[model samples]
Target: MSAEEKKTRQMPKGGRKGGTIFPRIALQDAVGYARRLVSKTHTSRQPRDVIYSGVVGAKAGIGDVRISALKQYGFLDGDAKSGYTADELAKKIVAAPPEELPHLYGQAVLKPTVFKRLFDTFQSDTVTRAKLKQRAADLKVHPDETDTCVELYVASLATAGLVSVDGDRITHLASADMSETAAISVVTDENNQSLSNNSTVNSPATRIDAGSDTEAAASDIGEEDKNGFPVPPGNSAQPAPRANFNVNVTLDSSMDIEKLQKQLELLKRFGAI
Candidate 1:
């Protein structure tokens, strides 16, 4: 506990200022632990309740790692010294239908550093084991660490359906079933110009076929309006007025795949799913 010893302690290898660690537990384990924590009571005075209830033992510090994983994933909030407390988001996740837990955990676990790095680096359509190694090299990760990272990625995120990994190929889940906000409808005219909400729209006239009238040409004088136009009442009907709407989609072609992939992950982490 001396000043020099404190300086040497700095922080654990992969740990930040807080006790939280990048997630190490698989998706199922994380979800199961979260569900169990929801049924327990955690008070400010008894923050250890979470660790005690969810983790088996501190053997080799596995228990600490698991607790840290939970905290990193937002299931349990607070640090080791302060104990852990389950927040509203955790409660909702626990109460969510069993089928939906994987998806929820996927989003939450992606917040960890390891997973975030993997996601961001492999945002392309297909990422192989070689690609993973290349990414590791680019990030200055040790060759040995690359293998471990790939294994961890498969066990957690890929297994959770948050991503796809076939053999060595990896893909970002761009079309995942994520929740979207209500889009404002912009009414527009045929000229592609935005129109006011109160604007009136005149629908096109509906055309009807007259019964095989081969002799209708002989009745030109039989039905003629004051304007000298043929008045075929049964053959033509005015269409009802209706609102015309146009959805304006502006695509930024300059945006590359990596940037778009980051946005998708960002949406997931914020619970837009």
Candidate 2:
């Protein structure tokens, strides 16, 4: 290649505004370095020299690359000027329980400034190797290196359980927190709709109009409304204005005696049964 062409190739492409540039290493590799650092220093701050010596040993060039990767992955905190330390997440990944690893790694993978931004941008969409390569190019990574970098980033995400790959297709996996939030929303909506849509208690979802069988059933109720069912409001002639409500109870084979007993006791406490 010509000298000018070679010079251009050396320049970082994706997003090249400023600073020391890319890590050029996968997140797993950087984390291995972090575990080595933690074995000696734990999470305590250490001068860059001491920290580097612990992880890198004699390979100075590879050390720079790996160290840059660690900082990018958020495994390392502090700066060259202030020295470096293993970040809390990094220490946890190295020593925390297996149950905690998935979450910790999910968080760590997004620490890199470039990958995090790209993830946010494409979070809702399925990712492809080609798509990631283009994104890496957008981040100022050189065209030739985009393919290699995309593979590394994808592999790192997979290690963290942050995505599932189907042959050539890759899908972003939801975090446990996101899955939990969605589950809660679904439960709340279903309950709100099922309990009170102005529908009847069982069989038919008939309207609870004035003087409906529902009100007569309440005449037997003493004073206060039981289980939200409207009771007769005194001896007034208003005939207990129409009110819509629904209470659907299902008795299935799975309803064990112990479970049924607890529910019955609760209802009895409230004079509901």
Candidate 3:
């Protein structure tokens, strides 16, 4: 080869692979390693290669075929993405499966910064009682209902090693030096109390006037005349006999008490009581 051509060939391709070199394993083998790490029996961490070999061995066995294919299928579901780094794969093979990973990323590899941010948010923003209250309000749930949702979110974050709880306080996985605002924003302004109140006010239950029947019954009873006493007939034995008074007060006072009681009972049964 010419000197110029040889010099050009000597130059490394793709700028020397950019960062640290990571060993690659077959998709099936990677899955098996992950499963073994997650299995209850395997407590110690195993290398990625060792896990892959185990997966291959398991696949060859009749009963183990289903398990062997699990990791492979899971990766294929995400379009052949292993979703884990070499070190992470090794750790997973020794520790647990991606499915059992407590965080949102599961067994998938994440940048250290990203993982740190996620954990920080989980700790400061997620665990605080105030933050939880805000979240519940934003979700339109009563404060009483916040515990369950917060617990679930915390559990998920724990799996990912993003946050840890100590009594009431949550310790983030990331360094304390990280920005607190990012974490604070997560639980802020999530309260839906206003929306909930509006919904309640607009609901059919509250909108209905329950005492309407009572008001209507009261109105049905005719109003008394302007005088302090009830108007009397001009021919009746009264001191003040108004010549223009023609309405009979005796007929008005003859209301059926029994009928009124029966109507009230019916209204009570109909939830208008």
Which candidate ranks first by lDDT, i.e. highest? Answer: 2
* TM-score preference between candidates 1 and 3, better one: 1
Per-residue CA lDDT of model 1 for 50-119, tens digit only, reads 4565443344367767777777777777665765667665787866665555556667767777677777
TM-score per candidate, chains pooled: 0.50, 0.54, 0.23
For 21-125, candidate 3 gives per-residue lDDT tens digits of 111332334444445545522444444344335433432343233333333223211111332222344344455444333322333323222222334445445
Lowest summed lDDT window (length 10), candidate 2: 201-210
Provide the clash count, candidate 3.
14
Q: In model 2, what lDDT does residue 62 have?
A: 66
Report the lDDT tens digits of candidate 2 across residue range 1-273: 789988777655684434324557777777778788777666467777776687756345666677778877778778778877777777878877565566667778887776776677666568788887777788877776777677877888888777678877778754555466546656865876887884555434343343567776656454654454334455876554443444356899888987777666645444454
Each candidate's lDDT (Cα)? 0.58, 0.69, 0.41
| Candidate 3 Cα RMSD (Å) | 20.7
Candidate 2 — which pairs collide?
Answer: 13-140, 13-141, 14-139, 14-140, 14-141, 15-139, 15-140
Poorest stretch of ten by lDDT in candidate 1: 180-189
